[model samples]
Target: MVVLPATLVPRLDFIPSKPHQRDGYEPEFRRGILFEIDLRTFLATLITVGSYVRIMISNLGRIGWAVVFAVLIALTIPWFLWGDGRVAYGLPVWLWWHIGWMIVVSLVFTLFANRAWGTGIEEGA
Candidate 1:
């Protein structure tokens, strides 16, 4: 039997580089849209532009869109809202939050589809 040298062995301590990162094993990240500051501001602008754009394409304006976006951002984050060690419907409070959030998202999506959906594409294009 032949013994392999250690140089041929793969290192177990290797750290993987994450996507959108600039360098390997470094905290530096690539310049991307998400890396830009003012995430909340950006989200607000996006929602506003999207709503107006939809209005231009369709007669109906986006309704309860800001509320939906606010709720989605608020509920998706697990920091501010704690579980409180409470359980409901055989599920934790935090889990219930997500479930309710999903239901709200589904309803909002349906509403957008029926009333506010727009691709910003021209009729001929």
Candidate 2:
């Protein structure tokens, strides 16, 4: 009692290739299901996403550095109040402090990835 969409149902003109020869090999016309996909495209998409996850998880040092930066920023309080309640460069000093922290985090992560992660490739190869 299997049901399939109209588009997925095998058409009358569609013929399955035979690998071996038979006495009277008239192509069997059966109402069977056929599924097709480009192997290269499927594998490429799978590999790309898998590689991204692998690289992100493999870089333990980079993750640790980012976590430390985040925790430090969250716990620090003096910088938030050190701005003398004034604005600088059209933004509050506290806001600038946060912006600077973000920049530092980006730089540290980039450096760690470049020097320690090593492009997510194996060491020997």
Candidate 3:
């Protein structure tokens, strides 16, 4: 059910490997369901983290650093929700909920990717 953004060129944004694309394809379905599932999983994780950050901000009455995090999360919702058009214009409650979730989940993703790819911090170095 996760349809990538219409703006996205398949090979460029996702499924970079031809073999992965071929394996995921189904003539009847048009695309593999695995993509949708993966998207959902990532989103769900983000929302969870956002909730925690929100609580921290609420208690502290917000701060400059908190605002920075909030802005970053706001920017990311559209990026991740890219191809889910209806998702951008659904019920207000649902939209807010998902947006919040995505913020947290994305931060987690950033941390995980950095560690996995050895981006910023070098382990034991």
Candidate 4:
């Protein structure tokens, strides 16, 4: 979702006017590092919880995205554990294998999201 992407990826800002001699461009993200982390945590948790609640309420008869959620969890668990602190923290060769696995699983879930909830995974404009 857009909110998750915004929270996860670093934000970039543009200059007020055109190119300036003194500076090229400066990012004006939230002031501190903790601010970024805390906001991301809050946003991610809120979205995840809210989505879960919505699905349970509206689709009691229909089974939900069991496989997608399961795959996300299954892959994410070992991914963080795969690394040796500094070196493989960013999903090395084998972890990337898991990521590739997730990609395949996510496509199936995308169709499921579209069909079940009438919400396309493409999201916003």
Candidate 5:
């Protein structure tokens, strides 16, 4: 299961208009799972995002950049440190790993924002 950050409120589960290919072209679920979406909440979200402009960033032209981030994210799980009982500076090894990982993440974000922000879009258009 792909996981999104907890802070992000994803687009609601309500499919506004497009009927499903299954379920006899109906809007309801096929497995008898009932979902309730409020009209007020839906309308509020629509208005908020109605005027939104999206910038699509694909790593098709920058495979190396994508690989770098993928490696960084994979190592963030600290699978190797699961059985670690070591302590450094009064903190567990995993905690120290996360702190250092966060620093690297921050630096990568800084580099991306400063150097690669909005790259390729203008050229493509």
Candidate 6:
């Protein structure tokens, strides 16, 4: 079989230096305000929230149902107080408050799932 010459291959360094030089068009990223900060902060918050969830689940076996129920009720009832608050980050304060509450509820549900549902499958089964 005949082999092709190496000189025929295109070199990356020889390519146009700029986008406009290569294709006569410059592309824009168009990232909105707070894009970078928002992503970093969101990831950090998610990690912190996950740690809290793990702690909550670990403690579930010790806390009584009454305490859990009380906390659940207290969290739910606070929504009324959040109404008519000043806006933050383009969303009503109450909306952000509820979003935080939802995260707690989700962690509580995770605890319940682990304790009440037995983590789904057995090691041997």
TM-score of 1: 0.40
Superposed Cα deviation of residue 19, candidate 1 (Å): 77
Give the number of the best model, judged by TM-score: 5
Candidate 2, residue 111: Cα displacement in angstroms equals 0.5
TM-score of each predicted structure versus truth: 0.40, 0.32, 0.23, 0.29, 0.47, 0.38
Question: Candidate 2 on 69-116: residue-level lDDT in tens?
Answer: 678667445454674778898988877777877787688678766766
Greater TM-score among 1 and 6 belongs to: 1
CA error at residue 99 for candidate 4, angstroms? 3.4
lDDT of 2: 0.59
Query: Lowest lDDT 10-mer window, candidate 6?
Result: 29-38
Per residue, candidate 1 scores C-alpha lDDT tens digits across 1-125 of 12223343333334332334355445553322222335466567789999887666453232355556676777675665574788888988888778887887888789767754552343311
Name the best candidate (by lDDT).
Answer: 5
Superposed Cα deviation of residue 67, candidate 2 (Å):
9.8
Name the regions of candidate 6 deviating beyond 4 angstroms. Answer: 1-63, 79-83, 118-125
> Which digits, one per residue and each the tens of the lDDT, describe model 6 over residues 34-66?
122244565677799998987676556445644
Tens digits of lDDT, candidate 3, 1-125: 45544344234335322223466673443443223325676578789979887666544533443565576667655565455545445555457756677777777668646634332244321
Give the per-residue Cα lDDT of candidate 5 at 22.
Answer: 65
True-structure RMSD, every candidate = 22.3, 11.9, 23.2, 20.8, 17.1, 19.4
lDDT comparison, 1 vs 2, better candidate: 2
Which structure is stronger by lDDT: 4 or 6?
6
**Model 1 weakest 10-residue run by lDDT:** 28-37
Clashes of each: 0, 0, 6, 0, 0, 0
Show where candidate 1 strays beyond 4 Å: 1-67, 119-125
lDDT of 1: 0.56
lDDT of candidate 4 over 1-125, digit per residue (tens): 12223445455443122222346565554232212235567778889999998766655524346555665667665654465444356655676566777787778777765666553333320
Q: Considering lDDT, where higher is better, how would the candidates rank from best to worst?
A: 5, 2, 6, 1, 4, 3
